[model samples]
Target: MSAARGPDVYVGLMSGTSTDGISAAAARFLPDGDVLGVELLGFVQQPYDASQRARLLAAMESGSARDYCMLGADLGGWLADAAAALLAESGVARADVRAVCSHGQTLWHEPGHSTWQAGESAVIAERLGVDVVSDFRVRDVAAGGQGAPLVPIADALLFAAPEHWRALQNLGGIGNVTVVPPSRGAVDPTAGVRAFDTGPGVAVIDAVARRVRPQLPYDVDGQLARAGTPVAAVVDALLAEPYFAAPPPKSTGRELFSAAYTARLIDDCRAARPTATDEDLVATAVSLTARSVADAYRRFLPEPVREVLLSGGGARNPVLVESIARELAARADAPAVRAFDAVFFDGEAKEAVAFALLGFLHVERRPGNVPGATGARGPRVLGKLTPAG
Candidate 1:
C-alpha cells in the first residue's frame, strides 16, 4: 500500500470485547506528536442482533477451523456494512479516504505465540474500494512477542509527554495499561516496552450482567455491583491464576477469562453463601477487575506512576471506577486512576485510531509494534495490506 502524502486522512475501524457496535474514526496524523486533525467524524454504532452476537461469541469461545472461516466472512460483511453507514453518516466518500485500518474482531488471542482477529480484510477492502491494513498482531507474535496491547505504540507517539509519567489504561472487554515513561527517546527499537493484560475489563462484568439480568446490556453504572460486597475467596482464587504472576511480555483474552470461568466463580462463591445473590457475583467480578489492576501496577511498574487515564466501556462504570480509586489511594505514592472524560473517552475509538496510526507508520516503513511490550526481537512493521481495485 502506498503511503498517502501531505497529512493523509485514514479511517480506522474497531469492534472490541463489548461487541456493542463498530467504532470508526478519521485521523490526520504526522510522525511527531502533532495531530493535524481528528474527527469522531463517523461515529456510528451498529449493534449485532441477539443471534448474531451469540454466533460471534460462540465462534470466539470454541469453534472448529471451518466455523472460524464462516464467522470471519460474516464478520467481514457486517464490518463492511458498518463502514458504509459510518461514511454515509459523515458524508465522506470511499475514494476520498486513504485506507482503512481495522483491528478485526479477535476470536482467539494467545499472546505467547499466535493470536487471531477475524473480519476478512478482503471483504472490507472490496466493499469499501480502499486498501485495508489488517492482521496486525500476527507479525508481532511471529517475532516472539505478545501480540497485544498494541495501543502502546500509539501511546508512545501521540500521548507520551516528557514532563509527566503517565499510564494509559484501556478498559475494553479486557483491561491493559501502557506506562509512558517521562523520557520519550529511551525506548530503543530493539528493546521492547512494558505492557500486558492487567485483567478482565467490562468483559466479565458484562457477561455476568447479561446472564443475570438478561435484558440490560450491562450493569449500567455498576448498580448491581455497587449493591453487593466482594467475595474474598472468589477474588483470592482468581488472583492465584498463573497469568497474574507471569512477568511482562504477556497478553490474555476471554479464552482465559471465559463464561466457564465465570461459572466456576459463581459455583465457588455460591458454595460459601449457598444463595449468593446475582448482585454479589457481579460485585465480586468488579472487585476482581479492579484489584487485579492495582496488583499489576504494584508488581510491574518499577516507579510510582502519577496518573492512570482510563478509556473503554469500563470507564463508564461508577462502581468499577470507585473500586479502582480506592485501590490506588492505599499506596503512599499511588497515582490517581481517573476516567478519560467524555472529550477523551475514545475508548470506543482508541483501538481503531491506534491501528490507523500504525498503518500510517507501516506505510512509511517505520516500525509500529512495541518490541518491549510485544516481546518481539526488534521493531517490526505491522499489518498486511490489500489494495483497493
Candidate 2:
C-alpha cells in the first residue's frame, strides 16, 4: 500500500547487536504522497554505562526470567531518555515529534522462529510523551519469514539512486547488505530489493579485541589487525558456516557469532596451527567479515552493482574498510566500494535514520517489511504502536 501522508518529525532509536550504545536520530519527513522524502535533522549516541553494558551483554548470552524483566524496563527507560536527549540536542520540540520508534535491544534473534528485543514501548511512550512504535520483527516472523534486514525497506524508499545499482552495506556487529536497483519508474521499487546478512562484521573482531585489549572497545583503526596476519584456513572455515551458503531472505546476529563462537574459532585455529596469536585470530576475523560480504554479493545479487555504500561502526575502521574494498576488487564484477559520505548520508547514523523512516512508514500505515529480504509471504506493516497517555 502507498503512504497516505508523511510522518513529519519522529525519533528513531536503535541499540544494535553491538550492545554498546543507542543511536537516536531525529528525522523530518517531507510529504511526497506515497514516497516520503527523508531529512535527518539530528543524531546523537547515548552510550550505555559500563555496568549497564555488562549487564546487557550477560542477558544477551543467557539470563534468568528476572534479569529479562528488569533489563527490559531499564532499556525502555534508557531508550526514552535517548530519544528525549536527541530531541533536546537537535533543538526539536517534543510537541512537534509524532512518535519515537525504538528497535530496542535485541536479546535473542532466532530468524524465522522467534526474536526478542527487550524494551517496553509503553514506558517509552509514557516517558517521552510521544507515541511509540516497536517490536517490528514479530509480524514478519509470524508470516513465515525471517524477521531481519528490515532496513532494506528504508534503502528502497530513501536511498535508491536512479542512476546505478547500489549495495547499502551495514558493517555492524553483523554485516548486512541491502542491494537496491536503480529506481525504475515506480513499478513497486521494493520488489527488486535484495537484502540479508553478509556475515561477520564487527562481532568476531570486537570479541577478540576485548579478550586481547580490554582497555579498548575495539581495534582502533584496525591497528591490531594491520600488525597481525590472517589464517586463511580459519577464515575459510568460518566462511563455511551454513548460514552463509543458505541463500537470501536470511539474517543473522550475535546468536550465530557470539563471544563463545569466537572463542571456539580461536581454539580451532590454535589446534590446527599451534602458534596463532591473538592478533592472528583478530585479523582472521576481519578477513572472514570482508570475504563473507564479497562472497554474498557474488552469489546473490542478480545485477552488477555499480557501487557499494558502506555504513555502521565498521566503516570507521580503516583496516576493515580497506579489506572490504580489496575483497570486492578481487571479484569479477568489481564495484567501487564507497563510504556513506559518497552518497551524502552519515553512515554511522544510517541505521538510526532507518528506524525513523520505519516509524514514518508505520505512521502512514505503509508496509515496512520487504518480502524479498525477509522471505515473508508478503509485505507486512511492521511494528506495534503505543499511543502516549
Candidate 3:
C-alpha cells in the first residue's frame, strides 16, 4: 500500500456504545512520530438529539438495510458537526486540518469475521472539506482477529512506564484492558502490551439503572449503588456468563447485553429475592463489572501487572471505582488503581484521541492494529480513507 502524506493536524470523532454524544478531539503529532508527545489542540462534545439517539438504537436492535444505509450518512453529518464544533472552538480553518478521523458509531462487532461501524466517511469528508479515515475495525477483523481493544497500541505508546507494569483499562460501554509491561529498557514497549475485553462495563449497569430510574440516563456517580447492598447471588449469576470465560483478543458491546436482556435479568433477580430494590440491582451490576475485570486478570494477564490505570466514563463513578479497588485488593498481586486523566491524558477523551493517532498513522502508512491485542495475522495499516473532493 502507498503511503499518504502525513497531516500536521487532524480531528478524531468518536461515539462509543453509549450513543450519548460525539467526543471530538483535535490532535497534532510531533515530527518524529512520537505519540507520547502529542499536542491536544481542542475538545468538544456534540450531543445527539433524543430522536436521533433513539433511531440509532432502534437501527441496532431491529432495522432494515435501508435504515442502516441511511442512518450512516445521518450519523456522519452529526459526527461532522462535532468536528466542526471542535475546529470552531479552536479557530482552526478547514483547510488547515489534515483529516477527520472517526471511529463512528459501532452498530455490530462480530469478531474474526465482521464488525460494522455506522457513519459515512464520504459524507463527513464532503461536508467538512477534509480527508477522512474511518471503518477502523474492519481491516483487523479481516486479518482473523477480534479487531478490538485497538487503543492498546496508543496506550502503550503514550503511557509505558519504565519500572511499573501498567494496565491501561478503559471502562466505556464495555471494559477493555491493555496490560503494558514495564519498558525493561526496550525502545518498543508495545511488544509487552496484552489487551482484551474484560466484559460489560456500563452497558448492563446502565440498562438496569435506566429501568429503575427512568428519569436519569444512568446511575449518577453510582450513588444509588453506593447506598444499597449487592446481592451475591445476582453478582455470581452474571459473572458465570460465557463471555467472562472466553480468552483474550475478544470484544463485546450492546448486542450481548441488550435492554431486553437486562430486563430479563431484573425480572429473574426480583423473582428470586422477592424484595429487591432498584439500588440493589444497580449495586449488583456494579459488582458484576468489578468481578469480571478481576476474573479476566486472574485468567489471562501474561505478566505480573502492578498498576491498573483506568479511562472512560466508568472512571467517574465512585461506586464502580471502589468496587474494582476492593476486588483487586483481595488478590495477592494487588495493583494500584489510578485514573488515566490523573496521570497521562483525559479519560473521557482517550478513545477520541486514539482515533486521532490512528488517523495520523493511517496517512503515514504505519500499521495500527496490535497483534498481541487484536490477534490479527500481523501488523496492518487500518482504515479506509475518504478524500475531500
Q: CA lDDT, every prediction? A: 0.80, 0.87, 0.85
Candidate 1, backbone clash total = 7
* TM-score of decoy 2: 0.96
Best candidate (score: lDDT):
2
The C-alpha stretches of model 2 lying farther than 4 A from their native spots are: 1-7, 32-34
Clash pairs (backbone) in predicted model 1: 145-374, 146-374, 192-371, 192-372, 193-372, 193-373, 312-347
lDDT tens digits, residues 171-241, model 2?
Answer: 98889999898875767879689899988889888888888888988898898998888988888887888
Instruction: Give the Cα-based TM-score of candidate 3 against the true structure.
Output: 0.95
Candidate 3 lDDT over 173-239, as tens digits, reads: 8999988877656566578677899988888888888889988888998988998778888778778
**Candidate 1 lDDT, tens digit per residue, 1-389?**
99755436678888887777677777767544332124445566678888888887898767888988888988888888877887888887776777888888988887666888999999998988888888888998898888887988777766654566778888998899988766545544223346778989888888888888999989999999988888988899889999898898788888888889888888888887777899999999899999999899888887557888888889889899899989888878988776665435456667777878887877777788887787788889999988887
Q: TM-score of each candidate?
A: 0.92, 0.96, 0.95
Q: List residue ranges in candidate 3 displaced over 4 A.
A: 1-7, 31-35
- Distance from true position, residue 365, model 3, in Å? 0.4
Task: Specify the poorest-scoring 10-residue window by lDDT in model 2.
Answer: 29-38
Cα error, candidate 1, residue 257 (Å): 0.4
CA lDDT, candidate 2, residue 159: 84
